[model samples]
Target: MSANKKNFQVPYTGVTKIQVGKKLGTSRLYIQTPSETYKFKFQFIKLEQVESSIRSFLPSSVLIESGQLD
Candidate 1:
């Protein structure tokens, strides 16, 4: 043990990947950051809405190049 000097308080600057899937009758969104991965679940919204919301948070250049993925 070298005294745990790593800082865990830094904010995520960008999102690297986004994935959407369904499980147990609920829709799930997976957001991959440099330091961590986040998951969100929704039961009412359509898949397109979920994707749009995620893209809204990302940089416009990324969306312009590839658009949203399935």
Candidate 2:
């Protein structure tokens, strides 16, 4: 994950979009920024944990929903 961070920085302010999906059997969290979309694979972290962590940083106005990407 550290290696992927070199490509883009997560925004400190501004409304960001979040999505979750499964790719090739790996669960991933997708963060959509103004210019690019960042993907983070979670092998150990549960879906609920990820949602909670992201919610801590974002404002209540930013809706965080949990569902399978299909």
Candidate 3:
């Protein structure tokens, strides 16, 4: 049932206890995933904005999007 959006992935280490419900973030926003039952803090990623940029899913032909790839 895992979608595995593949937007961002962070490897889990021993210290990070994997559980079903946990929080992950660093100020901006925190997202909770249904399955962390063996994974730790994988990695912090702003996937939607970041991924969209990479995939060129923007409407502006000029791609004037700034602050991305920061």
- Per-residue error (Å), model 3, residue 40: 19
Q: Write the per-residue lDDT of candidate 1 for residues 1-70, one digit (tens) a residue.
A: 3467653332334766667766665667876778787667889887667777767866665431223334
Error of 2 at 33 (Å): 2.0
Shift in Å, residue 38, candidate 1: 0.6
Clashing pairs in 2: none
- Tens-place lDDT digits, model 2, residues 1-70: 5688576556556437787656565667887778776778888667767777778877777776456764
lDDT for residue 25 in candidate 2, whole number 0-100 = 58
lDDT (Cα, tens digit) per residue for candidate 3, span 1-70: 2477655553322123211222444212222234543222324545344334333632333222222121
List the candidate numbers ranked by lDDT, top first: 2, 1, 3
- lDDT comparing candidate 2 with the true structure: 0.70
Worst 10 residues of 3 by lDDT: 13-22
- Each model's backbone clash number: 0, 0, 1
Model 3 misses residue 36 by how many Å?
28
Give the winner by TM-score.
2
> CA lDDT of 4 in candidate 3?
72
TM-score of 2: 0.64
Which of the two, 1 or 2, has more lDDT?
2
- The TM-score measured for candidate 3 stands at 0.18
